[model samples]
Each structure stands twice: as structure tokens, then as C-alpha cells.
Target: MKSLLSLLLASLLSVFSLPGLAQTPEAQSLLASVLALKPNAERGEAEFVAQACSACHRKDGSGKSAGNTPRLSGQHGAVIIKQVLDIRSGLRHNPPMQPRVTEQSLSLQTLADIAAHLQALPISGTIAKGPGSGVARGKELFAKDCAGCHGANGQGNQATFVPMVAAQHYGYSLRELEFIRDGKRGNSNRAMASLIKTYDQDDLLALADYMAQLPAPQRK
Candidate 1:
């Protein structure tokens, strides 16, 4: 009985202690800067195209391949700003994205605009299918482990800057999940890493498929 109580207390603490559940100082600063300027979705669209974001993310911000690059459509502007800052600051180690941050000569305003444009776009589209067997298992795992942070509908919690994962490409989601699970990605949340460690390759694929099949909620 003592052990059971201890375990429950530990679990509760873990939930509250997850990183990025609140905005960091850097993230808060970035959000302030972006908000200080008026976001122009039109300018953001031009900047996104000029930066060749469309090449990988597609013109609509829907990702190109399954389980690979994530769909950015309908993602919150604040989330986009935070990720851009993370990649720039090396908190997130995405090699391809690093150059865009450090060498691309894009200003903070451009980044803010791009984020606004992406957020304004709707996340409607067809997603690639995953193996049939793993989808059900994935749903179960997501409900048990992912939903608390990502939301029941996978819409993500904007207040915390969690990216929306619903209707994303399966291949992209799978690759990222693998990276986070394997500890290959930097700036990953410890709670997510711990949860993902229990999953095998098959489990990752299943979870990806389930998330990919989830419908995107209407933007408020």
C-alpha cells in the first residue's frame, strides 16, 4: 500500500513537471516581439515561398511525405515562433532548419509573418495511410499517454505551444517520434522521451498512423 501511494505521487509529480508546459523566458521574449509587430499573412506567404518552405512543407503548409516533415497548417502562430527560436538558439537540433535560422538572412519579422501565414491556412487534406494493424493500438497509446498534453482531439494546447498533430503525414510523424524516442532530437521534453522509450518501432508506427488519421478540429 505504501508503494502504491508512492507510485501515484510520483506519477502526479511527473505530469506537473514536464518541460515546456509553460513558456520559457526565451519563448516569452519571442512571443512578445512577434506580438509587438502586426502580423501580415500576405507578407508571410511571400516570405514562406521565397524561403522555399513550400518545397518541403507544400504550398498549403501540409507536409509532403508521410512520417517526415510535419504539416504546419493551422498550427498556432505562437508555436511556430517558439520553434523557430528553438532551432535558432540550438535548443532544437534540426540541421536542415538551422541554416534557415542562422544563414538565411530572414528577420524576426519575416519569421513572425511566416508563422502567421501558416497559422491562417487550413489543415484540410488527405493523409497517407499507415498499416491497418497498428492504428488501433496507436489510438490506445495516444489516449493513455499523449492526449493529456496534446489534447483528446490532437488539436494541441496553444497556451503551452504544443503543435497540433492531427491529420499530419504518417511518415513524418513516425520519423520525428523515432528521433524523440531515441533521444536523437535535442530540446525534446523529458516526459515525452520517457513515454516514448517504452514503444518499439512497431508501436511508433501505430501511433503515427493513429495520429495521422485523426481529424483536424475547426480553428477557433
Candidate 2:
């Protein structure tokens, strides 16, 4: 009984502690600088290759579904910038991405350019999807809980720095959603964390599947 109580207390502490871990001042400043610069997609294309980002994310930023990489094509530049900055600042934990995105590795201009290039890439190819059984429940949950922030079609808002979830890889989405729900993702939005805190594994599965099946937003 004592061990059980201790474990429960530790769990609560972990959850509460995560809220303070994200968005360092340095990260925010860097994000602002990156966002202010005019991105050169042409330069970005070259940089992306030079940086070996294509090795995992692919040349087109479609990401590797089997590798559990989130699709970056057509995602908002602001969203991408913020995530990169967060990872660099250690506000977000991505072991594989950490060394590659260090300050010495990516200049503000290069980061901006990379973001632009990825955002402009068209989402294509076969995205990994979940089992069809949960899609209906997922759709219903998204409409009720996620549509307001992520848009009805899951086309995330650029100005708000929300990511486009339409057609994202199912495995990646589910993994991230689970991380967010469990307070394991340090950079998670507070409101989003709160909203999903009570969600179970089944709920997360449905949500990921529904988002995965949504059509990719048409880029202008």
C-alpha cells in the first residue's frame, strides 16, 4: 500500500513538472528571428541535402512511416520552426534529432529556408494508416475536441503555429499523441496537455487513425 501510494504521488509530480519544461526564452527568441527572415526555398533545398535531413525525412520531407517519422510535407513553416527550435533548446526531447539541429549545425537563415522548403513540398505517396476499425470513432472525437484548434479538416493554422495533421503517418501520430497525453513530450501545449490528460490508449488510437485518414490539404 505504501509503495502504491508513493508511485501515484510520483506520477502526479511528473505530470505537473512537465508544464514548466517547454519554451525556454532562448528558444522563443530564436523562433522569432527565424520567423522574421525571408526563407529561400531554393537555398533550403540545397541545405536540406547538405544537412542529411533527407536521410530520415526524405528529400521531399514526406518522412518515413516505418521509422515513425512525422510527415513534414505541407506543414506550416512556423510550426516546423518552433519544433526545431524546441528540439535545439532541449525544451523538446528528440534524441535522434538533437545532435543534428544544434546551433553550430543550423543557422537561423538555414533553418528558415529549410522550413519554407518543407512546407512547400506537396504531400504524396502512401501514408501509413491505422486499422480501419477505429476511424469512425476517431472522426467523431476530432470534430468534437480537435476541430477548433486544428481546423475541421485538420489543416493546422500557420499563424497559430498549429501543425497540419491531415494524412500524417498513423504510427507517428499515435506515438506523439501518447507522449503528449502522458506528459512525456516536454514541448506540448499546456491546453492540449490538459485536454488529453484523461484520454486512454483506445481514445488516442482512434484520434490518430481519424487524423491519418483526412485528406491532405490542397496547397495554393
Q: TM-score winner among the candidates? A: 2
Against the true structure, what is each candidate's TM-score? 0.84, 0.88
Q: How much is 69 displaced in model 2, in angstroms?
A: 0.9
lDDT on C-alpha atoms for all candidate structures: 0.78, 0.82
Summarize candidate 1's per-residue lDDT along 109-160 as a digit string, tens digits.
8987998899999886667767767888999999999999899999986556
Give the per-residue Cα lDDT of candidate 1 at 214. Answer: 88
Q: Which candidate leads the pack in lDDT? A: 2
Evaluate model 2: give its lDDT.
0.82
The pairs that clash in candidate 1 are: 66-171, 66-172, 67-170, 67-171, 67-172, 67-173, 68-171, 68-172
Residue 149 error for model 2, in Å? Answer: 0.5
lDDT for position 56 in model 1: 87
The alpha-carbon deviation from the true structure for residue 178 of candidate 1, after best TM-score superposition, in angstroms, is 0.6
